[model samples]
Target: MPPVLDEFQGLSAFDAIMRHGNLGAGAEHLGISKSTLSRRISHLEYQLGQPLLHRQANRLIPTEAGTLFHQYCQQMLSLGERSQMALDELREEVSGDLSISVHPHFLRGWFNRLLTEFIEEYPGIRLTLTSNLQPPTREDDQVMLWLWEGPTRDSGLRDEVLGHQRQHLYAHPDYLRQHGHPQHPGELASHDWVNLIDRHHPDLVLHHPEQGEYRVSLPPSRFTVDNVVVHADHITHGAGIGLLPDHHVRTRSVAHPGQFEACLPEWQGPSIPVSLHYPFGHPPRKLGALLDRIRRHVPKDWGQP
Candidate 1:
């Protein structure tokens, strides 16, 4: 093996000189005197046993051998930088602050447990969670969680999808019994509709593998809720028939048996994807660790009914 060389400073000086094409500019850039910069280049050349640079008019030009040596020098400098960054990241992983902006809907389910467990496991991290109904806007330290639908939009932010949230029609047993259970999609129009806020579309669309697509115009709803829990509560309390996420329904069903039952179980509504977003680059070590925890602990079939 080649003898180990501890010449990072000298290598850096040479690289700076080559990049700037002169000793004056390179020394200025490195915040060193011309004499000090010249001494480093001389020492480096003596060790390598060749002239790395020569005067060509006003500028300093590298020789044919110097060109090859400069390439290696650049590689060494880059490796040193990357190595330092890795060490710094390792240090940051142990203790740092992380800011997260999450949609309020995500806090309703297993996400709270996930956050609780993460805080307990990694006490070093200072996690700040903010609630936002809109998509991310800035590229900074904060990581954002928002609802995604269909194919990803051309938003410049990078995202890691956690899971999907699928909606299906649900109603309380009492309401269905009182209003008479509807068998066909067309019969749904006669029943009272409970709409979620922002779902202004007149038609309710559903799809199936064998039966194809189904659409029905919704009548004016008696209740329009912005909060998911409130919306689910209204449906469970026999207020009206409404669309609810499968996961919420499952959790409710397990917690309180027969509270809400699926209506037209064969057909499925639109699927909303949950995604975590950050700026386009490697996330900070603290954020990276949290992301790893989410990926490992968050169940793949989290949204399944």
Candidate 2:
């Protein structure tokens, strides 16, 4: 007969210990004590009739069998998470943990305000915002909510087109007033261009509306920056002309007595597609609520309508 292993039967606690590799850390993750966990693992080992882990320097290393068990444990936890997501989806409740990765500029805009309102509406749902561009690490408990820039149909993820990011040419009112705004695209070369030095995609300049796209190769920085928010800051301070996303820069004109114009008509720019991605079927409840709130607030111009 199989021995009793009731205490350490749940996949969650097992996964937590497997993820951390140390007794104290694993116990901390499970909000338990090291001795209690040790007893549980010892019992489980007796039930399986094989050693699952080896001790070294007060740490735990998974035995060969333990490795296979750990893999199955992860899959089990994933299924459990989906089950919880399903129940939440069925209940139509948005109360849990919501995790998402976003562009840095989002923190300064709607994503910021949205959280406040969402919290006020569903205080039970905890929202975690991250700056990750790739998938969240395997051990991360929070579900990933990444910001998108285009139609992503091939990534094997279940994703929805959330919005479209419209970009525009912008400069400080003071700078434009001092140098005068360009009336045509060709004239843009004479003025200083604030380049966001992206290693993957070269700084685009010399736009040809008829052709649809342009990537200009220019020398070192008139104003070279890697962060979009930094570029926004520079433009707000009247540094130089730069390509700014309309989502970040709301203003359109050059200047008024009390206001600053951020973009001009002649140099109108492009739009990037944005989306919300997750695993197949029902996602977490907290994720649904956050997505709903975003969708509710996102304007028709954002591409949903």
Each candidate's lDDT (Cα)?
Answer: 0.77, 0.64
Q: Please tell me which predicted candidate would have the highest lDDT against the true structure.
A: 1
Q: Write the per-residue lDDT of candidate 2 for residues 62-89, one digit (tens) a residue.
A: 8999888988877766666655556546
Estimate the TM-score of every prediction. Answer: 0.82, 0.59
For residue 180, model 1's alpha carbon misses the true position, in angstroms, by 2.5
State the lDDT at 285 in candidate 1: 75
Residue range with the least summed lDDT across 10 consecutive positions in model 2:
1-10
- Candidate 1 per-residue lDDT, tens place, 274-304, comes to 7766667666776677778777875555563
TM-score of 1: 0.82
lDDT of 1 at 182: 76
Of the candidates shown, which would achieve the greatest TM-score relative to the real structure?
1
